[model samples]
Target: MRASRLRRAFAVAAAAGAMVFSVAGTSGSAASGMPAAPRLPGVQADTLAERYGANDDFIEKSERAARRMGDTARADHLAELAEPGRQFLSFDPRDDGLAVEVLGDLAHADRVAVVVPGSDTTIDTFDELGTRYAALAGGARAVHAEMRRLSPDTKVAVVAWLGYHAPRTLSRDVVTTARAQAGGAQLRVFVAQLKQANPAAPVTLICHSYGSAVCGSAVENPASTAAPLDNLAGIAVVGSPGMGLRSASDLAVRVPLWVGRGADDWIAGVPHASVSVPGATIGFGTDPLSREFGARTFDAGRGGHSDYFKPGGLALHNLALIGLGHGEAVSHD
Candidate 1:
């Protein structure tokens, strides 16, 4: 993503200055609770009130949600995730009583991939932008094909988790650890629902951009639950800011982890992994891409933040590997 785009992602109340980040540990005074969401797409007025009157209407049931997922036009979750004027954070809607689409036939399948997209991204972005303009997901799609291509025994269902409050543009806050902690509770709930829906399936979470932050916080218990973040064959984070924990080892789940950045990614240059909490601030001790993450590295070339998903990119190719339980790094270009 471009610096200008990054700035636009963040709806910061303060004017741009040198973004100050907290260097302290996760114990920092960051609000370890849920972050609030702004109104949905402030631009268009819902002059005609939504039909559902109950608050729970905003949240859909899992059974119906799964059907919605398979039908693209009925994609309420996507609209909620990218609707401007709403909070830019994305999480599993099933966790928040919101709607979510279920894909993949896990009963007979062997693998699954939950794709989490970053800022300025949408359902259209992956299918439209990445397919024609860039080579992202080229490899991701290959992995899907490879799953069926190489192993007919495995069935892969990839969910585009564009759910989280994105940077709106790119504010240090949007890229920090605070949001993770804030949204942790909801994330856990979402994962729980996903697992509940498909108990035996092995799940892999693929987080990109600020989506990584959601993963970081999800493991830490933003909602303060004893049910730890469990289940997972792997986690792949690309163009990430920082998991804020110093190491992926800190994550409650110990699945194989992978991290890589396009050398040209400006997000890697963002100064402090400063995450502001309610009273104080927190810092992700070290770079998440470090050995601490317990993940192998991939070469994204000069592709910036969003490049990993670009077609024919190694990052996208490797994502297929990770998603398919093939941890070995692969080349796309």
Candidate 2:
């Protein structure tokens, strides 16, 4: 009876999330001003300076476009994020959206952390001020600050990679990996570009919630990739439902896998299994923090779902340690 009730609750939540995704999806197409990226051969930017400059240029154009459309809120937000000292790896402002910001200098950094956010994240959400608790950009900034503080000597950079369409937390799409498949491909390309831009720097993927599914799918499928993933040092998943894989071995990445789950996170209740339906597969498989997943579990304290990157939280501390490549400093269960 208890298990049946849980399933019913998930079904309802999934339905709600699906409705939200539908609304967001309709608006998203008009918001991404640029066409889909072309199939380029080499680095997207010849140098870090060039990348930053190009992004700023794009932001300026986006700002003007936003004003023309009478979206002053978006214009103002872009203006703030496009300040002189800020560096963006990429920026596109159209309907719903994609923006990748570098929290620190990527060119000279010894280690870099790429943060992938989960459900209900959109460019509008990314631009919203004072919602750091719920925004990917704010979360990235906080994580970057913590990384700098914890590893003072290590020049670390954090990239807020809002590159994919995140599903709604209460929708049916949240239960499937279809969006994750597309997101994973995009992530793979971005990571490949990063590697080509800076071959020596160690890159770690810090995937949160549903973002872990993206990372998992990207690494699991090798034949679909244009470039091989040889630059990653580690992959850390926080507050995840699952990674669409049964075990760490299934991820097929030659790096350390770190998994963390906060005590107060409701995702712990998500069934750690998957089932195939007529059109698609529902549910991601094997919780990352579970022993059968073969991932190194860490102590993420008792914070809620979004608290992994919260300032001074144990999860943030551990994440910073991981971002800095100081695995020894991370606390284990």
Candidate 3:
């Protein structure tokens, strides 16, 4: 059984690697003969509509450039993403990467949820406009909808943050925390800037899969003197392999730490261990949902790996509960 799992892991990784190359290769602005997107407005904007307008203008320019370069598919894609009312905090046509969008009114939000996605999440696959289960953007919208459904009076916002270069499942990079380290720094800075703009709004980070490693890295390193992420109100890691830490204590954060995993998630089969490679340590250590690791485990239901944010699913419900500072109210298995 152990050998079979290892074989499956490698097979999945290989398949993931090839697909990623094809998708990511399409994102190069110079290679595609498209100009770079303009610099985005301040991400920490107090007026949500104003920020959306600025980003929309840049998206339109980039889309026009793509069309001029004869890449109509990309141009069309950008047009859909730039639809007038959508709230985009940033836009970069470089790697088709790191576009942040708010699902609700960020300006008056009492609570905010920042979604950190896992592997295979590029801008191309990040926003499949109408499909709810296929993309991170869909999941973020679902979460926002659920929050509104459950608590109509509460003003909440969900940020779909494709803020890092996610690794392919089959690549060697996936085995290491290297990418997570860089992503974590960016996330930390983003959260800090968020606090600066909305001092009264509490923030919760919803990390999925390898994105948990990014969240973990952003907090105290234990080995370093860097301060912990005290600005966050809470953090929830779902379908996590591990957080690049043996225990939650290693994160050194003051907020409540939550963990959950779906019963059918293939990640449950991956051995929860970390090893040192030539240049980096591969794999995150320790199962986060394990009692020994000490996270508040919540119910994620019987969905598969990518089903956590399903509109009416228990996982999404629990996530909404946690994001609203009702962690204790979250249902468990």
Candidate 4:
């Protein structure tokens, strides 16, 4: 059985390498043909209004640049982003773009949930209103809405964090930990900054699919300073492949970790094992929902991978409960 597993791992690795080579030859770099954006502000809650203005200016400038370059679709999208009442904590137009948007009153919230997305999530597809990828932003909004519905008196906020260059599903990078490692470093910094801005509010990380690997990496490798993530409430991963760890106990922190998966998620077929190559480790090991991994399981219902955040779904309801620090109320499998 061990030999068979190893052979399967190598076969997948070989296929991934071939795909990587083919894509490298045909596709341009992530940052290629992107318009330059303005500098972003430091993460400071007191200066959020000014920061929002700065990001709006950045979006407008990038919009003009895109327009000049004849990319009307991108320019139109930027125009929508620059519209009034949209609050972006950070915005970078270059390199597949990165945006961190708040869905509620962040300064006054008692609880904050950061929604980290999976693969194929980009600025262009961030909130494609009527599609599965809509969860990139729509999921955050749904969580915020559900939190309000569940506890009207509680102050809550949800952040749609598209702060990394997610790999395409078909790419070799999807099976490797390189992107997750880099993204995990960035997530740690961002969370630290967020804690500094709002020391009173507890933050929860809600990660999906490959985003689960990013969350796992972030938890596995914490900064070596005191209270690096002081007010982290909890972490929940849905539709995950694996968390790049042998067990939940391997996590660096002692916080509560939850895992859930829809019954029909295609990710179920992916190998939950890692193999070390020359310089990188391929695949995230240990299924999060497995007993050996030792994570609290939640009922994700019968939906597919993208339906986790569907309105009125069990997954979304449980996710909202978890994000609100109401783990006791979350339904178990």
Quote the positional error of residue 191 for candidate 3 in Å.
0.5
Ranking by lDDT: 4, 2, 3, 1
Residue ranges of candidate 4 with Cα displaced over 4 Å: 1-36, 129-133, 221-227
lDDT of 2 by residue, 184-285 (tens): 989988888887777788899999999999989878847843557888889999989889998999866679889999999999988777777678777788
Each model's lDDT: 0.51, 0.80, 0.79, 0.82
lDDT of 1 at 304: 78
The all-Cα superposition gives candidate 3 an RMSD in Å to the true structure of: 3.0
Kindly indicate the candidate among 1 and 3 with the higher TM-score. Answer: 3
- How far does residue 81 in candidate 1 sit from its true spot (Å)? 12
Best by lDDT: 4
Instruction: Report how far off residue 8 is in candidate 4 (Å).
Output: 5.5
For model 2, the superposed segments whose C-alpha errors exceed 4 Å read: 1-14, 17-45, 127-130, 224-226
Candidate 1 lDDT for residue 149:
48
Q: Write the per-residue lDDT of candidate 3 for residues 135-157, one digit (tens) a residue.
A: 78888888888888889999998
Worst 10 residues of 3 by lDDT: 1-10
TM-score of candidate 3 on Cα atoms, chains taken together: 0.89
Instruction: Identify the superior model by lDDT, candidate 1 or candidate 4.
Output: 4
Pairs in clash, predicted candidate 3: 13-170
Residue-wise C-alpha lDDT for candidate 4, range 1-333, written one tens digit per residue:
543564475567568767765643332223345555556667778877777888888888787877777767677877878888988888887746789998888888899999999987777667764574345888888888898999899999899999888876666677789899889888888888887678799999999999999988888856576237767879999999898988989877788899999999998887788888788777888999999999999999999989888889999999999988999999998
